[model samples]
Target: MRTAALLGAILLIILGLAQGDSDALGDDQPMFDVRKVEIAGELKYSDPNALQQYYDQLLGSGLFDDSMGNLTNFVTRPPWIESAKVRRVWPHTIRVSVVEHRPLAYWNAGQIITAEGQIITPRRLPDLPLTKLMGPRDTESVVLDQFSLISQMLSTSSLRVAKLELEDRGAWNIQFSNGIRVALGRTDILDRLGRFVAVYKSDLSGRIERISSVDARYPHGVAVKWKLQE
Candidate 1:
């Protein structure tokens, strides 16, 4: 009877040890099984549904592991989102916050320029009322920079550039809102622009109706193209 009691006690101890190991393994399980995911952002151009669906589907890929690097990379994959912040809310939730890019100018078929002159082609392009900028290949930043500087210089002037074009041959053409086009050759663009601005403010301000175009290729002065009367 004493031997039987001892064996029974040993079996009880073994069972208790097995149960404790099982509970410890359960404690190491995946952070409550990812019950919910939350994504928030000030989206001026992105579709909320698309973002939600994409992130929700990513749950199966183990993105719910609450890894900061994985979450950040997934959020920044969208073209409109310039940057993102990711966090794990603990227990069963993941959160992502994002910032959208501010469109500076219209670029090409589907691309747009940012204030920093970076080119981005988003998944969906929204129709924004902005000045059009066109240039040769790999000249997005150059054209954007020139547009910014010229726009600043013309802020006090009456004419506003509606379209700025840069050709492969290094020529520039600016069409103002008042239907006046200006041709600035490759070399000495800013100097020629300064000379033309002076001319517009002092001499051609009143006679704008009769002017058709302005050529600032001359070294010292600009050549005004006049609309001849019939």
Candidate 2:
């Protein structure tokens, strides 16, 4: 009876070990599991659904091999997406965190184009209110570069530029907050602009009620137009 009882106990231990091994193998398999997803930083313009769709496509491609390097590359490729992190939670939901892009201005296709000469679409409009910059379609970079110089000049003079447009012939037309247009010719921009500033400071600082426009293209001085009474 003792011998039979000992044999029974040994058999039970072997069976238990086999069951444990099977459970471990099951745990080793990759299961669709995500617990928590966190997103941060400038998400006002980003669509959550679009980001999720991108994530789904990547995961479906089987590119993420549960490795850190592959996962890092997957998240940072897009220009708009700043960063992304994915985590597995429990059963079948992947938690994804993402950072979005910020736009500087609304590039109007009719007036201004992007650096790539692609017509700036309304969909790419930025939330931030920036100065409108207009130029020929293929000359956006040149116009943008000039605008930066004009902006600096205005800053020094404590003036604000509402709109800056580049003419087809390469001249510049700028508007100020006070509803005045400044015609700056293609050449000698800085010198002509300096003359206008000197006139504003010495002659027309506060005496003029309104200024319709200022023509700064002439060699000797600037011609000012007074606003008509309403």
Candidate 3:
């Protein structure tokens, strides 16, 4: 009879171990399961449905062994999300905050440049009429800086820079909103720009539609090219 009792006690201990294993494997322990997920952010480009789905996964087999680090990393994986903050409430709740990248302009042909000069490739492009900026890889900061300065300089004029390109040879060129292109060459970019602005405001503003291109490499004067008569 003592032997039978010992076997029964051993079986009970084995059952207890099995139950602990089931809990560790994320089997719903009701009280420990995540019941709510709260997200906060000014979302513009990131997918809201995907965010909800990701969080819903937690409701099924959750926070039992999940760390806050994993949750934070998941929210920040989207290219548009610049940063994220995550918090876990005891028992069954998680709060997440995300910061999205503010797009400044279209970069290259398939990426976007943020106001902070970060280049990110997103799943879709924005429909906004943002000017396009182009340069070789690793030159995003240089191109963005020049665009800012040039835009600021032209703020007083009706001519807005619609496109800006920096050649691999260090030459720069700009296309104005009126479809006129200007070559700033390899040196004295700001000086050449200033000259072009002066000429544009004084001489070309009235006849801008007839202009094709302006070569601003000359030291004293700029050479204007007119479009062929149609």
Using TM-score, give the best candidate's number. 3
Candidate 2 off by > 4 Å: 1-40, 53-99, 110-124, 207-209
lDDT winner among the candidates?
A: 3
**lDDT value, residue 5 of candidate 2:** 96
35-107, model 3: which lDDT tens digit per residue?
7788798888878877677666667445556676777777677788899898777656877788899999999
Over 45-84, each residue of candidate 1 has an lDDT whose tens digit, in order, gives: 8788887777775453333554778678877887777888
Error of 1 at 93 (Å): 2.8
Residue 191 in candidate 3, Cα distance off native in Å: 0.4
Cα misplacement distance, residue 152 of candidate 1 (Å): 3.1
User: What RMSD, rounded to one decimal, does every model reach?
Assistant: 8.2, 9.0, 7.6
Q: Which residue pairs collide, candidate 2?
A: 33-89, 34-89, 35-89
As for TM-score, the candidate ahead, 1 or 2, is: 1
Error of 2 at 196 (Å): 1.8
Clashing residue pairs, backbone N/CA/C < 3 A, model 3: none
Q: Write the per-residue lDDT of candidate 2 for residues 17-36, one digit (tens) a residue.
A: 65665643345443333322
Q: How many clashes in each candidate?
A: 0, 3, 0
10 residues in a row with least lDDT, candidate 1: 24-33
